[model samples]
Target chain A: MKKIESVKNPLVKRIKRLQKRKQREKEGLFVIEGFHLVEEALRHDVEVQAIIAEDNKNIPSNHSGAGISLVTEQVMKEMSSTETPQGILAVCSLPRQEKPLSIKERGSYLFIDGVQDPGNLGTMIRTADAVGTSAVILGEGTVDPYNDKVIRATQGSLFHLPVIKGDIEKWIEACQTKNIPVFGTSLNEGTTHTAIEAQNGFALIVGNEGAGVQEKWLEQTDQNIYVPIYGNAESLNVSVAAGILLYHLKLFH
Target chain B: MKKIESVKNPLVKRIKRLQKRKQREKEGLFVIEGFHLVEEALRHDVEVQAIIAEDNKNIPSNHSGAGISLVTEQVMKEMSSTETPQGILAVCSLPRQEKPLSIKERGSYLFIDGVQDPGNLGTMIRTADAVGTSAVILGEGTVDPYNDKVIRATQGSLFHLPVIKGDIEKWIEACQTKNIPVFGTSLNEGTTHTAIEAQNGFALIVGNEGAGVQEKWLEQTDQNIYVPIYGNAESLNVSVAAGILLYHLKLFH
Candidate 1:
């Protein structure tokens, strides 16, 4: 085991940089903290570049195969995004899905467009995974899935399923081309989601919390759906809306 | 209009104290910041004690009848909970519902048990409101709904519906006595949520994030329901799960 005792150490500095979107992209690596996320990453076979633990913390026996480094609590805090460092963290390679997803596959898909809140994005991904969706595609302007807040929100579902970033327009076109119905959420000029029968496979697009699905993409969807607001609320939380729609589309064929 | 230029002003100090649960309980007052929330409170006919705004900010014309106070920007920041003060806030009396909810009403109700996350609690309340739930009953140990993060997450829905804090076990007994079926969520020994037919009026119980509904409550419910997880994700985010169940219970028969 290697030991890193200084916040000034290059490895610690590199981990700190992973906090930013640009840095994560530049390095093709991101940080996962806390015991559960680290264990999930290893269990799911996410490439573990290194497992960093605070000097007083014990690394799990199964994690011994991975390259391990021990660091002082100060050094751990320097690399942690959370207020209280979890004492264990991992640097894992971002998973890449080289193949374009096939809509003909027998599973639902979630496309997030310009969702800015990390918690909302993460919860949506977890919901998608819970419903056994095929994948979660991040359209341009969607918050980075690797964002620490977003990752924490996913509760390890980010590793359980494929989360890819791609062009929204292209994914919509692809779904339409393959005859997989694409449903975009809208506040108006659409049928209620309950009116749509379940499908073997489909794509659902949810948009920015404030702006909703873009008009251009709504035009491209086979059908635009809205959840009826029976009360005085202006709108449902984006992630909650996604969960309701996803479950309906998946379970009600 | 009273002008409070000092953060130490008695009124400013009192407003600052509204941030704590203890202070809020003692005063029977809570602080709601942001332009939209203040507007919503007024629109909903909530008892507005005072409207506080930054010196240069324009108070809405319709708000002229309410008591208004002008504070220096620094003073506003001192009383604000958010990173960026929205330049306006309202100190409103907490609405008290003296009568216990009747389950015989033709609407669903949400009972939350020990849900600790403010965002989750707020979003669930918003979802319940969106579905036209009769009311939201917060059991002991649930986060204070008036907490600023919970209030913000509600996006002003807090003013749109009834959110009462009470005993979970008693609420369950009340529903059963009224012959209104109560649904408790559990991970085991429960039918999938879809298995239950929708009802005209029902009570749904969601529990703590880590533990499902407490065994005592689950044992007394009409039926315990589970949302089937089709993928490897351990569970849905609590708010998302509540959204799915609420929509199903309200929209389908």
Candidate 2:
């Protein structure tokens, strides 16, 4: 039970640095705050490097054997990204999947392209997890999945599934190689999503909030589909659309 | 054009006050920022009280007959809630519907119960709008629809439909009077969403992020339904869940 009384402590400084994308990537670690996320990381056997709790807060019993640090509330506040810092936080090693993704014969997959909003990206991952998607492949320009906002929005689902940053074109090719149909969402060019019957294995690509699935990616997809807008809304929220599409493709015909 | 050079100008102060829920309710006015939302407000023929634009920005031509005010960049920033003020905003008379909501024979409706997140509430409204829902009834404890975050998340779908703050019990009674099957989402006590055949006209109620729909409300519904979670995630994001349920109930038979 090491005590970090100052925000200037080396360990505290390192945790704070992990808030930045570059620092997280360079060090191959990220910080997760709040008791729920910290617990989930430990439960999932994610490399829990350290558990930091504010002084006087009881560390969970399961944290036994993990490195623990007791910090002052002020230090915890400095280390936390949220407006209200939860008493507990954890530093975990970033999960690395060195092997390239292999599209399975009977699973659903989500391919996200240039989704800029962290909340959207995270919720999409959570939805993909909820729908039992095999993996979530992030294309270029997607927000970093380890970003605090994205992790908080995922509500621990990030630990539950493989969320990989990969090249979309290559992933599409892999799906094609496996004879898995890939669907791209488009506003103008595609048939309604209902037109595509649910299948045992499929990949659905949802794109940027504004630009949508890139023209190049759409060209590579086996089929392009859209959720019909029956009312005056211009389009569905990207994450919401992903949920509908994932559930429909995974569970229904 | 009238010019508002000071943040303390009565008009600027009044507009800023509208950002608070109390002031908005008292004045029956809300402020919307950014070109897209302001343009949507004008296009939808909403009661535009005044258009506020930063000095030197060209106001859109569609703003012809509306009251227009030019403000300094500082003044515009003072009146805007977003970090980057978009140079344009509008003070709109809140759309007031005096008559009670009458559930139609062939229309879908969304009822939100105690959803606290503004982003979730707004996104759900947008989803309901996309699904051609007749109205979105906000139950007690739901976030204010006119809150800036909620309005931004709605992406102008707020102007496209009736978003009423009302009693959930009354709305459920109205739906029952019309014999529109009301579906309340629950994790513990519902048939799978797909278990019930989609209907042309129905009412769907989704609740808070952490808690499912309230027990009292769930008891009032004609059916309680849940989207199955096939993976390790706890549950779907509230807005995403609404999108899935709205699309499933409205489009799939």
Candidate 3:
């Protein structure tokens, strides 16, 4: 383990700025905080390049993740965005992206269109795992999966899932070719998923947080669904809608 | 607008520590910063004990709901939890018991049970307004809806609805006598709510972040439903589930 104490260190500055989308892309890495999350990364065989934890932090008093780094509370705070820093953060390789049209080897998969919030993206990932979705495809305009907030919000599930960045048009073509039925969520009637029987081999298309799926993507839908609402909220947050749809698909199919 | 420059000011100090829940309750008032949120609080008729904004630095913009206190950018930062303070915060009287459950009222209502995260609670409130849920009821162990983070996460919707704090058991009784249906979201039973059907009088009961509704609350359900999962996430964030259910309820009925 290495000790990093200087706030002025160039590597520290780079880690601090990883919160920004542009910086994330520039450095090809993002920050994941909290012990549970870092441990998940380790278990999944995801490459954790380095770690920074609080001074005098506990490490099972027995074993520790391979590349752990110790830092002063002040140094940890410098790299943290949360008010109560967890005293642990990891610099890890962004999950690799498979081809957009690529079919998952098994089970279910997810396709998100323009989900902009980091929390929503992270929550969707965690919920996807709960429902047994195989992989996640990020269509154009989706938020950066590597954003610090998104990583922390995923609650460590990020390391377990196959979340890939890709193009919607390509994804549609691929799913169609693979015989995977593509479903989309809509405010209009494409299919009433509640009653319609679900089958194996499928991927659901969740739209932008506000706009729904881009109008054109609806053309690819074998089933277009909507969760029933009793009130006047214009739409559900993207992640929530994805969760409901994803969970329903797994349960019924 | 009366300007407060001292960090020693009890109110300012209290506002700064709102990141911690214990401090927030002991102070009996939570801090709400930024123009949009404060504006929403004012519109909602939430009682404001004080106002510290940029323009009204002196003579504190005193009003019936709020004691006016004005301050400069530096002072505002001293009182804000956000890194980029928006030059304003109002110490509003914590809203009184939020449950406005009256099935006879013929509107959509939300029952949030132990949804722990403040952001999730706040986001649900924002989504509630978007979906037109009449009000929100805080079940046991639910995070305080008035916490600084929760208020901020509500966007401007914190001011749009009445969020009640109470025992759901009694509220369930009120709904029962009034003949309003009480529906709980769970991991089992009811058909997929692909299309939300809003009824004249119904309450949507949501549960914890990971676990669905508790057994006690589930017993009170007139209907038990679950959102579908098409992906790998294990569960939906409670707020996201609430948003989806709330929207679908309005869409179909």
Candidate 4:
């Protein structure tokens, strides 16, 4: 492979356009940079369009296994959003759940109704992976999972988990039809998580970062769990709250 | 009282300089941005040298109660590290823990030893606040709590909680001498967290991002608790793990 030095290369221009969600979806791919993420893609067997390494150094020996390309540092930087680039980037296929999950099939799942912060949503997905969540259902208003910062924050767990995007109301209804229980988190008299049995299989619903689980969703839920605050700090970060509830559910698993 | 228009204005220059650790220490002040954080500082009554609202066009009436200096939008943009400025920023004192806690007095506490990521450390502190931990001890290698990103993440929980910075070795000895049990988390056979009476006065030691808990400190701890993993992802992000454990332990509190 020869290094492409110009920033104006059509490939580079196309890749740079990936910063926009429309571009990413239109191309059916997302770009992740840094040496670690590239390695993560291969390790997870995610589909890759190409490996783009700048500086002509530290290229992973396995790059040859995939369609690899050497890109100039300038070209790579033009495509990366991070302030510091690690001389490596890759375009990987947007992974989907091998089979789109019906609420009935995913017993231990997380429903993200409207988590807007890419980092927060990413952390929750990463936490979901740690706690053995079956999948993450992106409800209305949630940020795109493929957002570069989110991909980075997931620390490659993004590859391992099935994060399905769709109408949350429909998903919730599907779960209801299938007898799959839905547990929403709220600040009110929602049951304390310790008192609930998340292991038998349930979908954990986490709401918007600020607005919280919508009132309608909370009303529709089979159970509402709260982490119970003993202090006057108002509320916990949404991702942090979801993480705690997810781990609590794991107690039964 | 007056809007400062230039990036090079003396006060603006000082604020920019305080972005660095050394300058912040020399000045005994740090700046925190975003409307949420400034409100937190206000609610907590942390001393504020000034509240600078860059462009009052979008400042909600509630965010203006502090007599904030109305500055040009450009000045706010210059002072902000975030791509989008939150319109409000504050220069606040580095608050000391109001009730300093030693190991013996702890029922449940978190010791973040050597956590380097400002966002992770801040989330841990925020988790500590939500779970009602006795204190969060920042040992060697931890990022300063007042780092702009961290302070924002903490959402003023830094002010609500006992957040003390101290030497790692000294804090370890203090715990041992006081006979307060230590719980270190690891991938190995640290007891599964769910099985323990985790609420009993213990200090949970979380360590650096790359390195697990220090072996020396690991040896000093009384009990080690591990959050069981169900997936191939090697580890949890430090803050998420901390939040899970902290909230889990709160079941007893």
Candidate 5:
């Protein structure tokens, strides 16, 4: 096992770079911190590039298969993004996005279009996983799933399902070709979700925090559906809306 | 209209104190920031104590009924909790908690037990409002809904609903006496939610983020229900779970 004692170490500096989107993109890797997330990465078979643990923190030296490097407190602090680092972190390779082949015949999917809030994106992914959605497709302009806030909010569910980023307009069109109903949410007008027949195969699209699903994408969907707001609340948070819709439309029996 | 130019002004000092729970409770007031939330306070008819906006900011001068106070940029910054103050804030009296004379004979309700995250509490309140749940009762250990993070997360839904804090055990017993079925969520053992019969009036109790419902609360419920996790994820976020359960058990027809 290698021991690192200085924050000035080149390896420590490189790990710190994973905090930024551009650096993550250039290196094709992202950082997962804390004991639970690191444990999740190994359990889910995510490619682990390296594990850095505080020298005296008592985090496992080997997470089943990945070797850990022991680093001094100062060194670990420099590499950590959080104010209070949880003693361990791992640099994992970003999962490759799947090329659109065809929509599955009996699969449930969630398409997020331009959801800017990292926490909202993460919660939605967790909801999508809990309901056994086939995958979560992030449209253009959505927050990065691997961002620290998103990953933290997911509570390790990020590794439980395939979350891919791609062109949402194309994905909706692909679903239509396969006879999979694509449902978009709209505030102005749409069939109340309860009126829509539940089906095993479908895709539900939720939009931005403010301006909802882009007009271009709404026009491409098979139909728009809404969770009727019975109270004075203007709208539900995007993630909460996703949970209600996915379970009602796809999972409830 | 009073114009406050110095951060040292006594009224300005009192307004800033509302950010703290003790101060808020003593004054019986909470602070709301930004145009949207301030407007919501007015729309919902919550009692307004004061309005502080940037001296030159073009916020509605009268806000229909309440008077506005112009403050210098530095004073506005000092009064605002967020990094980017929206150039406006309002101090409003906290909504009074209902006396809990008894549970509504035939009303849908959500009981939160020890949910610690401020954002989670806020999101759940928003969801409750969307589904028209009669009231949300926060258990003794739950996060304060007036915390800036929670208030921000609610996105003004706080003004749209009755959010009361009280004793969880007594509330559940009260519901039971009125024949309002109480449902508790658990991971270990329970009937699947989809299998439970949907009814018009019921109370759903969601527990802490890490710990599920307390054993005592779980034992008292009419039934314990679990949202069947169909994927590898262990469970949904507390707020997301609340959204799914509330809609399915209360709103879905």
Candidate 6:
């Protein structure tokens, strides 16, 4: 056990730095706040570097293996990104996310292209988990899955699935090699989403909040489908659209 | 058009007060920040009380009817809830939210019970609007749709639909009399959502993120259905689940 009472401790500063994407990538580590998220990280085989607690009381009695550090309340608050510090947090190695060299035969996957909102990305990851997609591939300009807001919105499901960043072209190529059809949302052309028959496997691409699928990617999709807007709203939230589409395609299997 | 430079102006204080629920309720008004939101409020026919802009440049030249106030950048910053003021804001009359005494004939509706997250509530409202539901009834304990975060998350869909607050019991009873089936999500009991037939008119009730549909309400549902978890995630985000369910019914119609 280590006691870290000073707010200015070098270790506390280092832990606080993980809140930024650049620091997290540089250290190859990220911070998970609260008991539930930390526990999920441990349970999912993520390598926890340390458990930082405001006091020993905040640490679960069953917790073991990781070095425990007792920090002052002020120190914990300083390191926390949330307004109210949850009293306990764990520093864990980032998940080993790799672009798939090849896709599984007859397997469904989600390809997220340039979805920027952290909350939207998180919700989409959680939905992707619910549908049991083989994986989630993030295209360039997409929000990082490990971002704190995204992680919180995921509700611990980030640990339940594999989310990796890759080029859209490579992902499309990989899926096509496996004979998995690629689909995207396009209002101006192609079949309506509902009109398409449920398939055994496919790759679904969802794009930015402001922009639909990028033109280059849209051109390559084996099919482009649009959800009919039956009301005055111009479009559905990207994540909501993805959830509806992913489940529709996956449920039949 | 009126020009004001002081943050201490009486009218400026009133607009700032609209951020709080009690004040908003008493005044029957709410604050919407940003150019797009203000524009949407006008386009949707939401009664705009005033348009406040950081400078004359942010205001459209075609503006008429409502009083427009030009304020200094500092004053606008003080009145805006967002970190970066979008330079334009509007004070609008709150929508007439009330309990429904009768249900519409053969029209789809969404019933939200106790969802507390402003973002989730807002996203659900946007999804409900996209599906063209007749109305969205927010049960007791749900977050105020007028809350700033909720309003922002809704994009502009908050103006596109009727979102009313009411008792869950009354809503269920009204639906029953109109021969509309009330469906709920239950993990342990109920048919899988995919197995259930889509209907032209019905009420879909989604409960609190943590507690799920109250046991009492679950007992009253004409049918309970669950979205099967194909992965290790215990559940999907509530709004995501609602999105999947709402589109399922809407698509079939």
Winner by DockQ: 2
Which RMSD does model 5 reach against the true structure?
A: 2.4
User: Whose lDDT is greatest here?
Assistant: 2
Q: In model 4 chain A, which range of ten residues has the least summed lDDT?
A: A96-105
Clashing pairs in 5: none
| Selected candidate, larger DockQ, 2 vs 3 | 2
Query: Model 5 TM-score?
Result: 0.93
Calculate model 6's interface RMSD in Å: 0.9
TM-score of each: 0.94, 0.96, 0.70, 0.91, 0.93, 0.95
- Lowest lDDT sum, 10 consecutive residues, model 6 chain B, at B94-103
* lDDT tens digits, residue span B34-133, model 6: 8778888888888888888878787755457878888888889889898899999888888666644568888788888899999999999988988889
> Quick one: ranking by lDDT, best first?
2, 1, 6, 5, 4, 3
Better of 2 and 5 by lDDT: 2
Which window of 10 residues has the lowest lDDT sum in candidate 1 chain B?
Answer: B55-64
Instruction: Indicate the worst ten consecutive residues by lDDT in candidate 3 chain B.
Output: B56-65
Instruction: Report, to 2 decimal places, the DockQ of model 4.
Output: 0.65
Which of 4 and 6 is ahead in lDDT? Answer: 6
Q: List A-chain TM-scores for all predictions.
A: 0.93, 0.95, 0.89, 0.91, 0.92, 0.94
lDDT of 3: 0.73
**Cα lDDT of model 4 by residue, B1-253, tens digit:** 5678877777677778888888888878889888777766766667777778866654434443444677788888888878898887888777644345466565567888789988889888887887778778888788988888898788779888778887666676777677777788886657888777655566788989889788888887887887777775677788878877777665453
Which portions of model 4 miss their true places by more than 4 Å? A43-45, A55-65, A95-106, A251-253, B43-45, B54-68, B95-101, B104-106, B251-253
Evaluate all candidate structures by whole-model CA lDDT and list the values in order.
Answer: 0.87, 0.88, 0.73, 0.78, 0.86, 0.86
lDDT of 1 by residue, A124-191 (tens): 99999889898899998999999999999999999998898888898888887877889999986699
Candidate 6 deviant stretches above 4 angstroms: A1-3, A57-64, A96-100, A251-253, B60-63, B96-100, B251-253
Clashing pairs in 6: none
lDDT of 6 by residue, A123-162 (tens): 8998888888888889999998889999998888889877
Q: For all the predictions, what are the DockQ values?
A: 0.87, 0.90, 0.36, 0.65, 0.79, 0.82
Q: Can you write out model 2's per-residue Cα lDDT over A11-49, one digit (the tens) per residue?
A: 877888898999998999999989889888888888988
